[model samples]
Target chain A: MIQLNISDIQHFSVGDGPGIRTTVFLKGCNLRCPWCHNPETVSRDTVTLTYPKANKSVTYGRSMTVDEIVTEVMEDADFYRQSGGGVTLSGGEPLLQAEAVAKLSQALQGHGISVLLDTAGCVPWCRFEAVLPSVDTVFFDWKTSDPTIMRERIGGDLPLIKSNLARLLRTDKGIHVRIPLIPGVNTSEEALTAIAADLRETGAKTVALLPFHRLAVGKYEAMGIPYPYRDTPPLPADTLRRAAEILSPSFTVYAEK
Target chain B: MGCIENFITGMQPPWSDGRFDTPRFLEYVFNDGKGYFHPSAGLNTGTAESITSMEILMERLETQLRAGVKEYVESFNRINVLPDPENYTAPFLSLFCKDCIGRGLDINMGGAVYPSVHGAALMGVGTMCDSLAAVEQVVFTHKDATIAELVTALKENFVGYEDLRSKLLAAPKYGNNNDFADKYAVWFVDFLSEEFMKYKTPDGGGYYTAMAANVSNIYAGHVIGATPDGRRASEPLSDAASPTYGRDTRGATATVLSITKPDYTKVACGTVINQKYSPSMFEDGRRDKLRALIRVYFQKGGQEMQINATSTEVLKDAMDHPEKYPDLVVRVSGFSAIYVTLAREVQMDILARTQQE
Candidate 1:
């Protein structure tokens, strides 16, 4: 009776994968990416978002057994099979609960469902090893190549993330390196070059350039938290193109608008 | 022909005079015509005659349709003289009617006079001709169940086969953000819209197509036999471009994603997407979520959306106790309707709409 601490199960998550997917946003992240979109899921504790304007409050972080979660996700099993889509396990950092994810993925695979794991890859190698067998695809996040930026700004270990990515690439699985081109942070030429060098060493085939957006500003306000990037507008199209130009030669670059 | 003639004659004063006056009535084919496209409308039903035969039939139908309009206009002109000063009730309003004309026809489409047929025939509006639930549940879903058994159950309206109806109810449905069923819906809109775009109205007014049938879907469903979508014979089809009742298991976001997949720009007349959300979704900052949902949908090329904020509880109450909620207005497709005024089954259908949280 393994229970998973999850924030929300987002059904029909189109932007997260190739086809229609159910994104299980697991609670609690290992890294503290300052520009994190889902701030509520950053903590393992049950977080409540109160909207003073709407006079509404929603409490996230629930403990559900693997069987219950699987049963809930299986409702769309027919959809997954028909559309070449399936479930995606994302998080605060799903690798933190690698053992639980392994069980979840095994159950989903038993039903012949595809599993996509979206992670920031700041965890140990054993976590990836434990979950990689059952997972079908991995959306590995690469925020910055600068060790100081990774440590001080996002609370991530650059060496550890790179090591995890390199090892994950060794496995014969669908791996997509996702780079969130944060403004004034990872958008510089030096940072992009370092990021490309790490991916090239790992033999990465595909890279998705996700430009920064202020979509989570409202959510931050609702949760009674001040967003540092509240005034920060979306990344310009030119910057996205520039980043794509830098990475396109090494890998298949897809600029996500 | 007689209807068109009467319509024109009734507006003699308004048409002939340099005045503008509202006619008591103006009934034309597109306004009230309820029929399918001409079989020669080029859908390639796959069982039709050779391409040559189809072309010949298409030419003949086009001639007849155009002639029908031409004859009506000629007869109206023959009987009444326009641009006359005497018939003018109001000079300003009458000025616009100088070029005004209307036409109607009973263009038959091989007895498949469904809304989708008219859309395709007149403007190539794509339609979900197939039901995913029907295919998933009745036709071939159950491992041991055969099509014969499903057909038998459907013919009997599942009266004696409660188990089969339950099974059918459990099948995959559209509007769930799942591509399996949504892909069909997407293709239906795209194909019909593209097909309809290849043609135009006789007067070249840009034949617009619509998926919104208003409350007429209830009546239309009444005449339709048991469909593959697990609908019983004469049971109301899904209301106004919406997925069947209680079939869309996913939330509103998924529904929007699935519905918006169809390219509605081709749907010049527009497509209607009806969704019911809990009133709370409209409150406070939560309304922004709904707003964002709509913005995303529109950005994705959705033509139109009609939202209802009535809770299922209130709708059910209105159905049971109509006197309590007389003024309860529900957006029925593109128009508003009193919830209590709708039929019980229709009310049931509205109640069954997934009220997104």
Candidate 2:
């Protein structure tokens, strides 16, 4: 009888994980990253996206039972089998609904579908422990090593996030540390070096550096919020190369451009 | 024979995927066919000229087509009777210059030239551009080998070059929603459509183009050499309007985004955007996502979409057990037919289409 607040269920999502995954983006987040691409999933309350360019709007946030969620994600069961892909739970922070998501992941896994959890790792260790057994892989976001920027810009508790990542790393679950290379936010050499040191200590194997894209500019417009990165150009290819050079020594780094 | 005519007439490979060249074959359509000089020979016109003369000659070709069309119409009318089959249909493209005349001199956009069938469109630039990015990334950029070595390897059909081929294949492909390769596809569409737009049909109809090649990508691939996208020699080119089979690694959503990047509004003849989803994706709840995906695509100016819900399993079953699937109909390009009736290779080709969720 448990219910989860879901924003949207994207089928055949390749970006979230390996193969053809169905990414269920749950609503609400603890962080407030200014350049958060999926702003709609950030708020727990239902929000409508009005696009003046297309003269249309779309509302996010729907309540669905665990059975309904599992049924929806299971529709691509064949794709999951053929492509080695499965269900990925992504959101503003999937760990925020740790209990419900743990049940959801277990349900999906029960159907022989691999479950990947994509989260910011800002939640408590108990949340990670609850979902770790059900999730086949964890895409942990490592925004910045600096605590000041984390708290001021993104409203994240660096100590808490780091502790959760450290705890998750100790487990047998497959883990990938994702770095969103936001220029002027976390692309600095010093910051990347600090990140590399932390991830190296945590025994990180693979690191995916996601370059900043302006794709979410429209999302901000629809919500009537003035985006902070409106005038900011995308992270240049050279910057990505430089960042990769810094991160490569500790882990097998690749650019997700 | 039409290929030979295109060649004898100095037209470059004007067929789907610029593979056919001026024929070197000596076979003749008529007794006097061998006697006529190649169009290039006439362009020389016994004149020593450079840039200006070439420009002037280029301008004269259009005029020549207009004149020849005029003479053909006059002759056809004079010789035709009430019962003449030619008079009824007036098949426009069989005659030389009709394709160009229909676009340049003709006013109607009704007739279409042989456009780049989806898979063969990359042939426009040959293997150079498509493979150039990969070569740059794998060999040159990575310092894996020199350009000369890579060229030699390509000449050898990548024999003993398994590592290099894999690296090239790993390079971003056209339909993977990666801007690196998809940009070329966008340019291919825009360049061809824009070029055709310059010509008008005789009836003032605008020139239209198509990416739908039906099954010609298979035939076209037979003549093309190994390409840079790591496609082996004699491998089928991407079919219909879809990307090279299985090259769209990002699944259906990304493929849709990449395929819909071209301005279909400029293409009056329409294009076919093919997607194959497993049978399960067509089920009640999941079918709505496919519909929404298509709705999003069309809303973004996509002209046409051709989706096949038949899974590879069903297709393979149909192949092995034709008696069991008498009514199993599958869409092949613009039309649908009994699955059992199609050629095995074609059936296999449809079977290989990347089936998504």
Candidate 3:
């Protein structure tokens, strides 16, 4: 009877996780990062996006029981088994509906499918505890090291987020600390050093630096909202390499384009 | 266009009591006596109403196999003994000159080093497998319709059976690496090749089964009736050995896995597994992924694959204004052709091939 608000389920998602995974974008996020690519998933309510040029309209946000989600994700179980991929629960924040996510993850795990959770870790530690029992891997996002920027700009509690990430790192589960390399937000030498110092304290070993892209401009256009970073060009390859160099001394770095 | 049932019935020789003169029958059907006739093996299996019942399908296939073997033997026997070789022209006679000088016989008179091994092009492996899977799933597994109802539905060309046709279309298809459907394809190649291998040419050459059907699929589809795979009466029948166009919703990897399930060693005449990709897949960085995919396919015993790298947008534009892109060449089955020179239906068929991303 438990239903989770869903945004979209993307199959053959190679970039989300290790192999050919199906990323289940759960509707609703607590954080408001300005450069967030998935703007439509920020709100819990259903929203429709219409693109005039493509003559296509898409509606996001639906309520589906865990059984329905399990059945749909299980359709690609063979692909997952073949390519070492499974389901990736990503979202505004996947831990928002902790109980439902726990149930969905448990059901998927029962079918021998690996479940990975991609979260910003802004929620309370209890939410992570609720879903971690069934999740095989955790892609914990660490946005910025500055407390004021985390609070005012991104609407995240730095202390709470850092504590949750540290606790997740303590567990035996696989943890991949992802840093979205927003140019003005977190790509500075000072900011990279600070973020790496904080991550080192949290005992994180591997960090994936995701370069910022303007691909979400169309999403903003469809949603009828002006993207703040529309005029900003993507982070150049050299800048991404510099950021990776700054973090290499603290943790193993992978600069993902 | 007449259906195969009507064609077969009309091909019954008047002099004989319900017995077909296989040579004359093939001559009238394929070549009109101008060229040779290679029996299209398993082309009509999916369109036959007996596909709803496996017992009847097996029986029909057995009868067709016997008739096809007879035609092969008769054609080879007749070609082996030509009374006079002097009537042929110089260019035609020159091909057998070495044989005539060395063995004092013409090529057709068994003087050539190798006997003529006829190539029986097995058309519509995808169509046959999809149709069988649809029947097994809809009729046997789901019990959504009975064999009698399905036969009637096909007889009516699914006019009032849209719901049934949708169910059939929604069933598990062949190109998704699902064993439920791919097993039928495996059996199809094994059974047909094993049976054809038992027969030999007059001078002892084995029959080679080919999955390459040039542009003949369009013509073959014209004669087939509504198939259980939800294909209408006159739609092109699943070009070459590839799946029904647009049915492979899964990406390229699953398609490669599904197609390589059949043993290609038994198919000495080669297969044409057509795959299309966006032009970007042929670019510098992504081209390596495509190369790796083909490497895996060949490593898994795939005999041959044909890839088209033109984007659908360009193809659509070419269709709209043929003069704009005269040099757009594309691989069609076992051969390549100038895109604008092909018929519109063939163009549409090429455009319908699922572009793997």
Candidate 4:
């Protein structure tokens, strides 16, 4: 069966995972964050790749074997070693293609290469359960602890996300909670303290502070869609630093990549 | 003028198709009595008094260029501000070209204290020079009688000298690559730069100047007259004050080729050569061999490159097929031109290079 539906494969990225990682953007997403940069990934169905100059084209990927995927990735393995970066599996949600993610991660791991899985914890717990053994680290994105805000910004099933978090905590995998602190939206003093508290409760041990940015504005124009969070300003760098310092005492809060 | 009889004479096809031949060009330029004549003028000597920021240069250049380009478009717009100033020289050169081609104006370029023109030449003078310069020389050098007669002729407005004006306008100038001339031009510039850039500025601003001169995007050249060498009329040159094109070998080569110490140091010497083939050869994968040739160029101590990077069919199509992409900018050897605006033979050279496949 055609298992993996990838949106993009970006190279020479310095701030994705550990170092310079090749972040593979898989196509279908489960949650819809208002400030999402890769909004194209949110839909489960395949769509045309659109350009801002009024051009549109089809996506280019086929169902390849685990070995075929590994071969494509290893071409830049030397760059990974030099830069202390490896492969970061991110997407609509890598967990959406759980079996493929599991197989691909294990293949890369068997080759002694590092792998990172970036996810929004709303997927079925069994999906993460299958991929956990191979993934070196899981960047579990958790935007807000307040269930109402979570549902409003991104159509999130917060209780299920928290429960999935609880299950991951029970296991021996490394996990970090990624909270994007958007001012007037999610970046309140209360949200920081509350997220710090929820992360501590999850026993995740690390929470990364993700800041908002305007880099995704062009993508919205390209897709011919009005971005709901268009007017939302980026969380100032100083504020994130201050928030990181504020939340540090609770659970090793660090800035998100 | 005394060495006129002693210098060895060479045969030239007095009639030209007006494409790319140096001897015909030389014969046409030297036909009658001329107002300006200098065999050996020193290199890189001018009067820009070395002001350091691009801000001041832009303020002064913008005013003059607006006047030069007033007749072209009805009104100025925001896009005309041209954030990219480096590509402005050829356009400026085009303005002087249109003026010289439209009237008999023997305007001397590369003279006096206009820093903007010097700045433009430093960009890439090889492609853009001779065309308009030839026209200016044509008007000033005609069936004249005495020294006073020539001087008086120089003062006449382009409209008064209608016959010479039309002849001047009728001639096409160089900006496109012509092998024999571009090669010789390096020698002429080398001669001028060596002798001219010897002393410090009269203003104590050292004579050593390396500036990026394409200041505006108006496609304008500078107005020069009665230079030390003998530029007598309002010679139109580029006023777009920024830098030169194709990296000047010196700027591109990691080493900063400046006039700080020894002048006219050979940094990265590059020239536009003639290619006989057209686009059909390259489209069939001749570019691989061309790429390999460049690899050898770097290996054999050559560095840096910028390509016209389009196919000949497209070039031929652009010229013959002008209705297709009117805004196509192809490298006319050193300078670039919007393909539709280029003359036929210039378009043919581009077609030949695309054949390198």
Interface RMSD of 2: 9.7
Taken over the whole model, the C-alpha lDDT of each candidate is 0.64, 0.66, 0.76, 0.48
Q: Rank the candidates by TM-score, best first.
A: 3, 1, 2, 4
Clashes of each: 20, 15, 0, 46
**Chain B structural similarity as TM-score, candidate 4:** 0.31
DockQ, model 3, C-alpha based: 0.14
B1-357, model 3: which lDDT tens digit per residue? 111111111111111001111121211121222212223432233333234455655455555555665666566556644435576323344353445446655555555555545546677878888887887889878999986687668657799999999899889998887899999789778876776677775557666566666767777776566778888776777766688889987777678778889997887656678889888766654555566667667777877788898899999999999999989999886578999999999999999999877
| 1 versus 3: better lDDT goes to | 3
Q: Runs in model 3 with CA error above 4 Å?
A: A1-13, A17-118, A123-159, A162-257, B1-58, B61-114, B282-288
CA deviation > 4 Å runs, candidate 2: B1-357
* Cα deviation of B165, candidate 2, in Å: 53
Question: In model 2 chain B, which range of ten residues has the least summed lDDT?
Answer: B22-31
lDDT of 2 by residue, B234-290 (tens): 666676457777777656767776777767665545567667877766665455556
DockQ of each: 0.07, 0.07, 0.14, 0.01
Task: Give the docking tier of candidate 1.
Answer: incorrect
Give the per-residue lDDT of model 1 (tens digit) for A126-223: 98889999999999999998989888888989888888888888889899999998998999888899989988987788999999999999889888
User: How far is A110's C-alpha from truth in model 1 (Å)?
Assistant: 0.2
lDDT digits (tens) for residues B1-357 of candidate 4: 110011111211011000111111121122221223322122121123221222332233333223222311212222223224353333333333324334432112211122111101232232233322332344333422232332333344333554444444333323222222233234333433332234222222112212122221112222222221122233322211111122122111111111111222332122222222333324433433344434433443333333566665577677766888878887554356787886664454345431222
